[model samples]
Target: MGISTDSTPRYTYQLPVAAAPSEPPSAAEGAAASLQDALLVGNLLWFVRLRWVAISALTAFGAAGLLVRGAFPPLGLRPPTGWPFLIAALLLLANFGYLGHARWIVRNPQHRGAAWNLWVQIVADLLALTVVVYFLGSLETAAPFMYLAHVVLACIFFPRWQSFVVVVVASGLYAACVIVERLEIVHTPGIYLDPLLRQAMTGHSAFPWVTASSALGIFFVVWFLASHLSSLVRQQERELADANVRLTIAQRDKTRHMLRTTHELKAPFAAIAANAQLLLRGNCGVLPGEAAEVVRRIAARCRRLAIEIQEMLQLANLQSADEQPKPLRLDLAEMVHWAIARVGAAAQARRVTVDADLAPAHVVAVEDHIKMLLTNIIANAVAYSYEGGTVRVRCHVAASDGPVITIEDEGIGIPADKLPRIFDEYYRTEEAVRHNKDSTGLGLAIVRHVAASLEIRVQVESAPNCGTRFTLRFPRAG
Candidate 1:
């Protein structure tokens, strides 16, 4: 509901920068502005419609009163039919004019002038209601309560101070009407009747003073409560917006720091792996058996470390990218086959069996991210499974839930307590660390991040020594 200012710069550079030109809004910015304007116009139109309803009801009530007076002369209670008709006609004319103005503002939102428009409408409504109350016996009848309705409306659409101003002005006008009627300055009929209940009573009495005082007291109390509640809600909304802005800033800073550190580490590890591989292959010279075996182990570990650094860099880039990858139509079955092929070597090394039940289904997603997500899940399953255990992968469309991809493995399953933190970066369970010492613990984290970017839902079910199942549900593309 609130708009944030983009005064904070996104990035800084050492190089000299050129002055940027003032340009038109981007598509996203324009769409957001258009949506805001549309909402404002809708609110204004709704207020205008409510006024039309109020005016119609007033006209109908006036006509009914005139009919009752004509039919029963013995009642002897004179109603102000002529003045009600005149007031209703004037109100209808003003409402029709304001409706036209509201439509014009909707068409020309740049010139809407909301504050002035609201003030004019509210003041006019208060005046019209005061006239109606006067005609309907003022403080004697329940028509004075109508001012409270206007007070509530003002509280909803106006600022707290402005609504209070409305309460003050309305109370003053109604109090003046009561005073004049009590003093015979205007000969309006009162609500009381004679002993026979057939004649109206003339009053210069204490009842009007008491009624006016009570009405004013009620008005102030209603205004105070409504204004205080509105202020609290606005304050909460502003606080939430500020918190979100701070979180976004902190995330961007963390991503930048990780990207720089990982880039520096990757190069040295790559050189170390290359030199160790040369020595192990006898490219430099033939060495003792023990020396060659040590070099072989060093080369293998370095290569694995390099791969882990590369994955970390990929994750950092995914987090920092401002624009998301656009989704494209792709075959789910083909993507699953690609992922199986990716983990074929790992599965073979573990002596694990791979099974797939794929149905021909198409979805919309970034092809590379989806393929990488599948590869990570399947590779993790292969890495964790026992020798000769089964790794099952399935893909198909559900009757009510769109397309789903599931990978299940009879692996050393995660502990119940560690399930919640499994997807956190560098979070490996104790059992997992014992089974595979070289595990970087970044596979599930990568899987989670990629799935989120592609709008896929991932659900996990596992028990210790009972195997684990990971299910991914994809939304249908129109």
Candidate 2:
């Protein structure tokens, strides 16, 4: 006979009786590619956001001061008596406004539209800044210094082709300004070059060509230095990134090796202990009193050591496993049946009965990982159970949630204070320690790791002297 219900459940169990529904690549390259892309994108975003703010602010301040000065008085030449300075002022203001918007967007990257707008505004501002510099100073005058800002901006914000383009455009604009000023179309500063001895005695003039030539030369030098520096920085970033990846991999491998070694050592010990128990039980032949007692103690200690090794191995396995998961369709009903079948015999000895109500549903998960995860939870339910206790495993499926598997046991329940620490390695409740001293205190810890790897949300509910319940919910696949 099985537990009767209005609806037929997937799995049901009775003492010596059952009704059941049962069942049961490139990874490395993809992981590396994903890691590389994440780092590259992250770095690009940082540089763009930081440098854009700095350049835009300085450009706005300088343009505003120029506008204010030109509006008031003049230096030897007449004020730009037309739309030139006015247009420059407006462009500078717009650039400054957009820079402020960009800063806000940078801070809140979750707003995709704002971030996009910021990028567009930065590009427009760069263009506007280039034009303003041309009007303020031509190659023979202040144009050279203007290009210096563009060169620096290019080196920081834009990379190869774009940086080159900005420099060339600034230089070309400066040259054009020089020609117009010299023709008397625009008010251009005059140059008075001094001899080497004369220049040593007096400071350089405020002339166009002389100053433009010097400023333009400085622009080139700074541009070269910035380019060289950026290259070095990029190289160092890449090296550090590579080293970090190597270190992670080395750490994972080391953990895996240790776990595997622990498992290897544990297997032989388990076999020895099993044989010793059989001999002591007289499964082969009757043993003397002293020999039987000694065998029992040896077997018991071996069992304890085996559990410790198993726990260690589990930790090692989880630490070294792939970060990226391999997902596949999983049948919740079948997994419940399979898990019960695996741990059925162990529970029977303690007279613990399993009552599972799993529904027919599919979720995505790694097959072996899911099984190992369930085994730890179900086995624990059975192990902690008292004689003639019941372990109920229920699965619920909803339109929103694909499947929720809950394992609840009516046994020596955990205390409220100790529930939080139950998942920690080497931790056991006072009740558990008193009831069973052989526990290695790693079952729930392993369960936690497996749940995390599969992206499944797991939680527990317990009341002292009542029972414990562990629930695992799996997200639905699209």
For 324-376, candidate 1 gives per-residue lDDT tens digits of 57889999999999999988988998888889999988888878878878988
Identify the leading candidate in terms of lDDT: 1
Cα misplacement distance, residue 420 of candidate 1 (Å): 4.1
Estimate, for each residue in 73-118, the C-alpha lDDT of model 2 and write its tens digit.
3333333333344554565566556556556645764443443443
Report the poorest 10 consecutive residues by lDDT, candidate 2: 15-24
lDDT of each: 0.75, 0.65
TM-score of each: 0.70, 0.57
Q: In model 2, how large is the Cα lDDT of residue 94?
A: 60
